[model samples]
Target: MSNLSKLESQSIFLLREAYRTFRRIGMPWSMGKDSNVLLWLAQKAFCGRIPFPVLHIDTTYEFPEMLEFRAWAQKHYGLQLIVKINEEAIARGVGYETHDPVTVTHELKTVALQQALAEYQWDALITGIRRDEDPTRAKERYFSPRSSEGEWNYKDQPPEFWNQFALPPKGAGGHVRVQPLLDWTEYDVWLYIRREKIPIPPLYFARNGKRFRSIGCRPITHPVPSTASTVDEIIAELYSTRTPERAGRAQDHHERNAMQKLRAKGFL
Candidate 1:
């Protein structure tokens, strides 16, 4: 089998395992390229129908294109989308400008996600985080466990050699964080997107020699210099590019430990 095919097979396996093992399972959709591919795979896993609710945590700071694509995709795929807004935090102006992006991320993303999970009572959250996207995310496992209150212990993870995952012990009440795309890389995602014909937001394409390699809130994310306007071109660019995927992300530059701090606090 080809490498992308193997990656798809493993992701499908992880998605099924998470659903069968946990009573209530959920998947968070960031509406980015990787997460969108994850959503497509989830539907394919269930025979063209996804069984779990898809999550979209709207901080009201997302790029307009992201919100538009999300809305369209939800209807196009007939997704069971559950949206949660951090209205209070946004209202208080806790954005990339008014405060540390880390603080903004915590208040708007981490805290809001915990509240929604508590209300929904979901035991596991399927995330589309690939290790190659960020150095901090490289520590994640296929079946990483979090505290009952949504705290992630990234520092102490279980051994998972040979596809064996050590699940959390009983009485360690908490939600399980499942990462099906943990092994896929940035180029793998683009390849899969091209193969599957999955629709992604147009912001990823370059416009006048600038394109967003990693998309986030418009204000917090800057586009890199790129002439790659199509998926094929983007793939070719990545083949020789030495730049990190998240280089355009402002938060990563603001602090070295920014992504890890967000993950430890449950920012998916």
Candidate 2:
């Protein structure tokens, strides 16, 4: 079997297990390549029908194309997409223009997600986090348990030897974080997208001699000068590029522990 097929089978198995174990569950959709691929896998896992709501925590500063693509995908794929925005934060003028990217992300994305979970009574959350994305995420389990405050204690993560995931302790706020694509890498995601013929946002393609290596808000997201406009070209470029994927993400470059700090406080 192909590597993509193997990854798909593993993710399908994990999705089914999470569905059977959790009561109230949802998946985050950042309108990015990873989450979009996860959405596709969810439909495949459920036989062309996704069982859980797809959540998108809107910070109100996302690229306009991202929102448009998200809506189009929801309609085209028949997805039950729930858009959760930080209304209060926006009303209070919280954004990248004024505050630092890290703080803004905390208030508008992380804290916003926590509030949405509480409001929706979500017992579990499915994410597209990959171990290869960063050092901290590299330590996560397939099924990660968080405190009531949504803090991840990586030091006490459950063991998953031989695909046996230790169930989280009962009565833990009926909430857990599920990661099915934790083993997949950046290359795997692109290859899958290519093989599956999935349509991604046009911003990934070169425009005016620049292409966004990573998608984020306009103010904080910077694009590198690249001539690759096609998926195959992008894959080739990635093979030759020495920069990390998150190198252009302002928040991630803010500090040594910026991502870890944001994630520890419930950032996705």
Candidate 3:
């Protein structure tokens, strides 16, 4: 099999493993390329049916285009999309306009996610986090278990030798976070999208002489100056771009270990 085929097989295996092990499971859909790809892989793995609901933490600051595309994808794929909003934070004006990105992310994204998890008891959460995305994420395992408080202990991860993952103990309230595409890179994601003929949001293509290299909330996400208007062109651009994918994300720029700190505090 080709390398991409191998990656696809491993991802599917991880997805199946998570499904088999966890009773109540869910995946986060941020309306980004990674999550979109993950949703596609779910359909592929389950033969056109996604078993669990796709959770979307709406900070209310997302770009309008993102919400539009999200609705479109949900209908197209028959997805059970659960939108979790931080009403308290939004009511209190806790976003980039009034507060810092770190504070806003913690209040709007992290806190909202924790509350959602509490509302619905989940045995595992399947996320689309890739190891190549960042140095901190690079330390993640294919099936990393978190504490009851939803905290990740990077130093004490389970052993996964020969593709065998250690299952979390039964009746454990804290669900494990399963990463199916931990080995895939940014370029690989684009290549898979092209290969699968997946429909991506139009924001990825250049419009009006600008395009967003990485997508996030409107206020925190700034597009890089790019003229690539097609998927093939974007793939070529990735070959030459050396900057981090999250570089344009304002929260990542606010502090050196911002992502690490957030993940440590159960953000993701």
Candidate 4:
């Protein structure tokens, strides 16, 4: 099999495993390239039907195009989509200007997700986090468990070499996170998107000469200068550029361990 096929096979295997191991399994769909790719993979794994619910934590600040695309995909696939919003944070004026970017991240994303997970009682959350995306995410596993309160214990993790994984024992009181895309890189994601012809938000394509390298809330995300207008051009740009995949995301730079802090507290 080709490299892409191998990756697809592994992701499909994990998706199936996650469904079998957890009573309540859900996937976090960010409507970004990576997560969307995972969504396509999930469909393939379940024979064109996703077996678990898909959660989208709408901070109410995502790009407008992202919301449009979310609605489109939901209808396209007949998805069991759960739209989550942090109404309390927005009502309290938790934003980039009123609060520190990190604080906003915690309130709008981390805390909101904690509340949703606790109430939903999903035993496993399948997210689209990639190891190469950020330093904090680099410490993740293909199947990592979190505390009942949704706190991540990154310092202590099980080894996942040779395809072996350690799912937290049943009734151990916490849910495991299934990261099928942990091993994929930005280049890999683009290649997979191109190969599979997946639908994605248009913000990634250059408008004039800028495009979003990473997508998040509109308040904290920025577009990088790029001339890439098509998927092939984006793939070529990824091959030639030295910039980090999330270079335009402001939250990563405002605090030294922003992503780590947010992820530890259950931010997507």
Candidate 5:
């Protein structure tokens, strides 16, 4: 098998494993390339129908294009989407424009996700986080467990030897984060999207010589200089680009350990 084929198979297998292992499972879709690929893989794994609901934690500050794409993709893929928002935080005037990045991210994202978990009580949540995306994410296991309070103790993770995985115990009052795309890279994600002909948000492509490599809230995410207007051009650009994938994320620049702090508090 080719490299893409191998990666596809392994990811499909992991998706199946997650379904078999967890009593209740949901996927978090970010409307980004990696999550789009993950959604496609889940469809392929389950014969074109996802067995569980898909959750999207809205911060009320996302780009308008992202929200439009979300609606389109949900209809196109027949997704059972559950949209959650931190109404209390929004009511209290918590926003990226007014509050600090760390505080706003925690309140809008982490707290919103926590509220969803508390209401849904899912056994597992399948996320599209890859190890190569960030330093803190590199330490994640395939079946990483969160505390009852939805905290991640990165230093105290269980071991995963060979292809074996360690699942969180039943009735732990917490959820296991199933990372099916942990081993895939940024380039690999683009390649898979091209191969699968998956649809992604158009914001990723360059417009007026700028494109968002990673997307978040509008106030916290910025675009980088690029001329890659198509997926083919994007793949070619990756071959020689030296820039980090998330260089445009303004929040990452706000603090040295901003992501680590947020991830520990259950930010996805």
Candidate 6:
């Protein structure tokens, strides 16, 4: 089998395993290329009907195109979307405009997600985070567990060898962060999107010689110079490009340990 096919099979297996093992499961959709691929794989894994709700933690700072695509994809796929927002933070005027990137991210994304998980009582969250996306993420396991307070102890993570994954002990009283796409790279994601004819937000494609390689809130995410306007062109670009995928993310530049702190605090 082709490598991409093998990857797809493994992701499907992980998705199924998470669903079968957890009492309640949800998939967090960021409306980015990777999340879109994960969503597609979830539908395929469940015979064109995803069983869990798709969560979107809207910080009210996302790019307009992202919000539009979120609405479009929801209708197009008939998704069970649950949009969560930390209205309390917004009311307190916590945003990029007033606070630093890290504070805004923590307040809007991390806190909002915690609220959603508490409100929904999800035992497992199917996330689209890939190890190749960030160095902090490279330490993740396929069935990574978080504390009851939603903190990830990366240094004490369980081992996964061969195709065996170690689940958290029974009655561990914590949520599992199932990363089905943990092994996929940026190039693999683009290739899968092309192969599956998946619909992604147009922001990924270059416009005026600039395109967002990794999308986030518009205030902090910048575009890189590129001429790759189509999926095929993007695939070709990935073959020769030396740019770090998240170079456009301003939060990474804030400090060396920024992402590690965020992930430890459950900022996926």
Q: Estimate TM-scores for all models.
A: 0.96, 0.96, 0.96, 0.97, 0.98, 0.98
The per-candidate count of clashes, in order, stands at 0, 1, 0, 0, 0, 0
lDDT of each: 0.88, 0.87, 0.87, 0.87, 0.90, 0.92
Candidate 4 RMSD to the correct structure:
1.2
lDDT of 4: 0.87
lDDT of 1 by residue, 1-268 (tens): 9999999999999888888899988888889998999998998899999899999988788898898898899999999999998887878878877788778878988888988888898889999998888878999988888888798888888889998866765235588888999999999999999999999999999999899998877778899999999999999999999988998888777877888888888877
lDDT tens digits by residue: candidate 6, 1-268:
9999999999999999988899899899999999999999999999998899999999998899999999999999899999999999999999998999998999999999989888999889999999998899999999998987888999998889896988875335579999999999999999999999999999999999999999998899999999999999999999999999999999888987999999999999
By the lDDT metric, which is better: model 3 or model 6?
6
**Largest lDDT belongs to which candidate?**
6
Q: What value does the lDDT take at residue 72 in candidate 5?
A: 97
User: Where does candidate 5 have its weakest 10-residue lDDT segment?
Assistant: 163-172
Model 1 has an lDDT value of: 0.88
Q: What C-alpha RMSD separates each model from the true structure?
A: 1.3, 1.3, 1.4, 1.2, 1.0, 0.9
List runs of model 5 lying over 4 Å from the truth: none
Instruction: List candidate 6 segments past 4 Å from native.
Output: 170-173
Q: Find the 10 residues in a row with the least total lDDT in model 6.
A: 165-174
Residue 259 alpha-carbon offset, candidate 4, angstroms: 1.4
Model 5 root-mean-square deviation: 1.0
